[model samples]
Target: MIALPFLKSVAPPLQGKRIYLRPPTLSDYRAWASLRAESREFLAPWEPLWAVDDLERGAFRHRIRHYDDEAAAGTAHPFFLFRNTDQRLLGGITLGNIRRGVGQNGMIGYWIGAPFAGQGFMHEALSLLIPYAFTKVRLHRLEAACIPSNERSIRLLEKAGFQREGLLRSYLKINGMWQDHLLFALIEDDARAGK
Candidate 1:
C-alpha cells in the first residue's frame, strides 16, 4: 500500500532482464491510475473492494506514507514492476506482515495490470524477489495465498517452487465478499537447495 511526488529516499530497485522492481512514486500516478481503471473489471474479482476514492491522488500519497513507514520499521517492502526498456509500470508486489525474531517470515502479495498478464513479468519478479527475501531480508519462510479460483496465481506459485500447504477458509474479502484461498509457502532451505 503506497504511492507519489515520489518517496524522499527511493529504495534500491531489484533488477531483472526484462523488468525491475522499485517503490512507486508520485510520478507513477497517471500510469497506475489508467492501468487500474482500465483493468478494474478484471482485477475486481481478485482484489478487495475498492474504496470510492481509491484512485485519487490524495489516497495514493497516503498509501506511499504508509509504505514508507512500514519499510522503515522493517515490517514490509513494497515495489512497482517496470519494464527495463520503457519503464512502464507493469504491476506491484509487496512483502508484508513480516515476523522477526523467532518467526522470520513474510507474506507476499502481488498484482499485474491486465495488459501485462501471462507474459511472465511476475515470474521474473519472483525469481528476483525470492532470493532477496531469503538472503537480503534474511527471512526463513515466504508465504503466499491466492483465491481458490485464481489458477494463474496457483500455477505461478508452484512454478516459483512454493509448495501447497492447504486451504484457508474465508481467508480474505474480495470484491465485497469473503473468499477462500489456497496457501502456499517456500522455505529458505528448499530455496537454497534449488527447489
Candidate 2:
C-alpha cells in the first residue's frame, strides 16, 4: 500500500441522496473488472481502447497507487460511485489535472457501468461531486470534454451545469481513433447560479 501523507487534506467521501463517492481500493478489483467487462460494448465508443491487462489485479493495484499519489500531491481526486442503499459500485468520476494558485481549475471525467446507466445515479453523483469540487477541493473551474457524437454525455454535463464552451478538433484519441470533442465547463459562479 502506498502511503499518502496528505490523505487527510484530500476531499473526503461525498455523500448524496442516492449515491456516495469514495476512492477506489484494492478490494474493488473484482467488481470493477466485472462491471467493465460487462459494459465494454456500451462504453467502448467513448473511451480509449483498454490494454490486455487493464482488468488485471496488478493493474488495479498500480492504478490505486497512482490515484493515491495524485491525491497526495493535490493534483487529482479519483472516486468510485456507489449506490447509497446497497453500496453497489455504479460508476467512477475523477477530477484530474487540478491546478491551483491562479488557475484553481480541474478537468472532470467519468464512466458509469452499463447496468447503472440511465438511472439518475450518475446525475446524483455529479450533483454531489460538483459542490465538493468547488468547496472542498477549492476549485474555481471544472472542465469536461466528450466526443460530439456522445449525446448522453453531452446531456449529462449540461444537466450538471456545464455550459458548452466550444469544440476541439481531434482533441483526444478514443478507441484507437483521434476524435473531435465538445468542450464544456462550469465555474464556481455558474454552480452558484444553480444552472
Candidate 3:
C-alpha cells in the first residue's frame, strides 16, 4: 500500500451578517448566468464589455478555471457572495493582485447582482473580507479604485471605512477605456480605530 500526504489549506471562507464569501463552484453557473443576463444593462456601464458569447456555458467554465488558477497561485482570492442562511448567490468579490513582502497589500474589487443591489449585501461582504485580509492573511492595507462617476460605489467604500486618497489620472483601463479613478484605502489600524 502507498501512503499519500495531505495538503493543508491556508485560508478559509469568510462570513458576515447577511452574506458569506465562498470559493466559486461549478454548480454556480445557472444562478450566476441568470443574474448577469438579466442585469446586462445595469452592469455594462461600469464593467468591461462582454463578448456576444461571453456567458455561454463553455465560456463560464473557462472563467472558473482561470479563477481557480489565480487563487492557487496566491494572486487572488475570488469568492461568490451568498446569502448566509439560504446560501443564494449574490455576486462576486475579489482581493486580487496581492503583493506580499514589503508591500503586504492587495486590491479590492466587487460587483453585486442587480437584484441584490441596494440591499446592502456588498457592504456586508466587504465588512467580512477586509478584516479577514487584515488578520488572517496578514495584509497591511486594502486598496480600491472607483471610477469618479460611480457615486454609489464611493458611498459604499466610505461606509466600509475606506478613506479617499486622491484621484489617479488615467489610472486604469475600464470598460474598454483608460479612465481616471478615485483612490481609496483602508489600513488595518484605520479599521481598528473605527475611522
Candidate 3 lDDT, tens digit per residue, 95-179?
8888877998999999988888999999998988988888776789999999999999999999999999999999887778889
Residue pairs in collision within model 2: none
- Candidate 3 stretches with Cα past 4 Å from truth are 1-11
Model 1, runs deviating above 4 Å? 1-10
What would the TM-score be for candidate 1 when compared with the true structure? 0.94
Model 2 C-alpha lDDT per residue in residues 61-178, reported as the tens digit of each score: 9999999889888899999999888999988999899887799899999999999999988889889889988877878999999999899999999999999999999999999999
What does candidate 2 score on TM? Answer: 0.94
Q: Candidate 1 residues 83-177, lDDT tens each? A: 99998999999988988879999999999999999999999999989998887788899999999889999999999999999999999999999
Screening candidate 3 with a backbone cut-off below 3 angstroms (N, C-alpha, C), the clashing residue pairs are none
